[model samples]
Target: MNTTQLERIHSGKGFIAALDQSGGSTPKALQQYGIQEDRYSNADQMFEMVHEMRTRIIKSPAFDSEYILGAILFENTMDRTIDGQFTADYLWDKKGIVPFLKVDQGLAELDNGVQLMKPIPGLDELLKRAVERHIFGTKMRSVIKEANPAGIRQVVEQQFELGKQIAAMGLVPIIEPEVDIYSADKAASEKLLKDELIRQLASLDQDVKIMLKLSIPTETNFYSDLMQDPHVIRVVALSGGYSQAEANEKLAQHQGLIASFSRALSQGLTFQQSEDEFNTMLAKSIHDIYEASIQ
Candidate 1:
């Protein structure tokens, strides 16, 4: 990332809008909202619908970029043109919304029942393309299902390795080690995650600043110190299938960890509403999340 782009992301407004759901996630999200899968048989068709949904929000009169520092983009939508302007250019030029690309392919099952994002071949080439497109950063994800120390360690190690590579490419990486919200050992898992993060950070170069997207904790202020680490540019929380209200409540407790939510951020929005109603609903949602974020 260029210095101006880095400053744009690390600025005091720390919220990130996670609209980067991949082909695997997009179809399901559309179905949940009553958009029939029969109507969109392929990924490109689904992306068109998804882009329409995102376009509505970004083009809304009440849309406020101040509530979000950046937006994470799906592979197809990253540079696709909408209204004769590239999506990234539209967001930045029109609303000052920084663009971040989601570089990970979908996840694959890993050892010990864990899941890791499929390793991208030629990721260096991809990051170069993102830079050429003027994208500011990248996000990659992995999932932790149990409190198994070994499994967590593997995830931490791999994520940091990849994060360091991203930093070397001059792009900030958002390392997302998402804990299962349904886990019986949520608190225990968080402790393991914290320990693993600290262990990994010790080995990372001090100048390689990165961001994190963690599952919101049930306990209040569990990651305060971790968020304050100098290597951690920003710490943001994922809703991890929680409802908007529940996510907001949990997010409020973590002082510096702001929202990078997907489902929670779009919870009340729908295709049935009029454009005016849609904008009003989204504006309210953004305001509520922003309030929780800055708390």
Candidate 2:
């Protein structure tokens, strides 16, 4: 995949990871999120999904050409029953696009042995399958999470190694941190992650692309505030159903790398639901804060 185009689509327009309860293989379920119906159940769905995606590209009203539509294929999406839809090649076929497998997949790999972390049991075989058919641009990998504090240095380093192997095979890694710390001192929490991420990036071989996933700080700092430290590379936030205006305010403030999430469409006692004014309240405020960080 062209890192330039992938970077362009992700710079301001971001990706959303699915927290949906549906089993991952169901193409029809993917349809709810604007994915193609043929994208599930088997590999045969690629033709349909790619065709529809092109149509949407042609019909988009907003200047969305710079963005991409993502179907987050997390662990739930990895069921063999739905093998056709979630494989590495299905994603590689699309131009400048990313196939977002959930972060949990990588975390799970840290324990099973680092080799398990590659795209599939035999990613080479899969890519060989793609190459034989002249497939060249599909990038694959997962939204990432540092599962435990133990052995994290090894985990991060090895993951970088995994990314290198994948890149050799032609795929990009969407590095992310799971929102695991909630209710802690927000400032300290952010600092902990920010500091460590910088350290990890420093540990890497130069020229590797690392994307930092951060939540829209509703009760924290602004994007500019986070950018004060130069160690940061990319900033990602939620597009999870926030109002376009809410998302925009955040976007305007984002200064570096940026992406979106789907948390806004979710409902719970903690969700911010006041529509009183776009200037303040809940997801809007958080999104505004996050959008600014990504800029």
Candidate 3:
């Protein structure tokens, strides 16, 4: 493990930036950024366009480590360069931010009222490559749609199972098991998910601490116990499908949880904004999220 990065993450006073939109979600992300599908003809062009958006965000004046502890990258972005340095290196060396990689292949079809992650082939190889690039950790996601114990157990189990492998490689894993915010049984699902997580976390060895990324619970401080667990390094909240305003409002009620937002983080950004306008908007967003995180 990178002890410096580990300590920074354990004690950092900022939210994480989730910039890992993959192929399936790239169009929506680009569209929100004021780019349309017609602007790109193929996959390569599509990726190029999205990469440009990510690069612009990373290079912005407001994206420093002061209110942004880390940023998670897609595999392509991880392999790309920023201002003549690898993306991870640029984040750590130039901006004083830690870097993480999104490792899941994406969720599988909904099953048993949940959507577990698809198998991640070559994960070990990917972890090795991430280590070479100075990556501090990784993130994977699964989803819970209803209050089904069987399904939630499977999701949590899969996350921890893979988390151990990631830890064995000396990389901390942000195990994300997201509960759909719009589900009728959202609160119930959150409870079941939390129970399962505690059960699984208790079985781990003392040295194998991990991070968690979860949807902001319907009840304020619902995850407070998990935050106090010694096995958990930190508990971060995903914006899920909430708008930035709504997400930040919910996040503020939880003192220890911080944000790791995607759409929410890039909410008002557009491809055509002037640099000054872009920076101003970004600075506001970062400040709002940071305030809510530390509240």
Compared with the true structure, all predictions reach lDDT values of: 0.83, 0.40, 0.94
As a whole number from 0 to 100, the lDDT of residue 232 in candidate 1 is: 84
For residue 156, model 3's alpha carbon misses the true position, in angstroms, by: 0.4
- lDDT tens digits, residue span 114-231, model 3: 9999999999999999999999999999999999999999999999999999999989999999999989999999999999999999999899979999999988899999988998
lDDT of 2 by residue, 1-295 (tens): 5555355534435443333223233343335434555435554464344333322322223212233334343333332212244332344343333444443223244441222233346656654544343232222222223333333344455555555654466544544443333324444444444555556666656555544455554343444444433433345565424554665564455455344443332222121223232123333433444444345
Candidate 1 residue pairs in backbone clash: 1-170
**Of 2 and 3, the candidate ranking higher by lDDT:** 3
Give the worst 10-residue stretch by lDDT in candidate 2.
Answer: 265-274
Per-residue lDDT tens digits for candidate 1, residues 227-281, read 7788887888999998998888888887888999888877777878898888888
Error of model 3, residue 295, in angstroms: 0.2
Stretches off by above 4 angstroms in model 3 are: none
TM-score for all predictions?
0.95, 0.49, 0.99
What is candidate 3's CA lDDT for residue 51?
A: 91
User: Going through the candidates in order, what is the number of backbone clashes in each?
Assistant: 1, 24, 0
Cα deviation at 277, candidate 2, in Å, is: 24
As a whole number from 0 to 100, the lDDT of residue 89 in candidate 1 is: 86
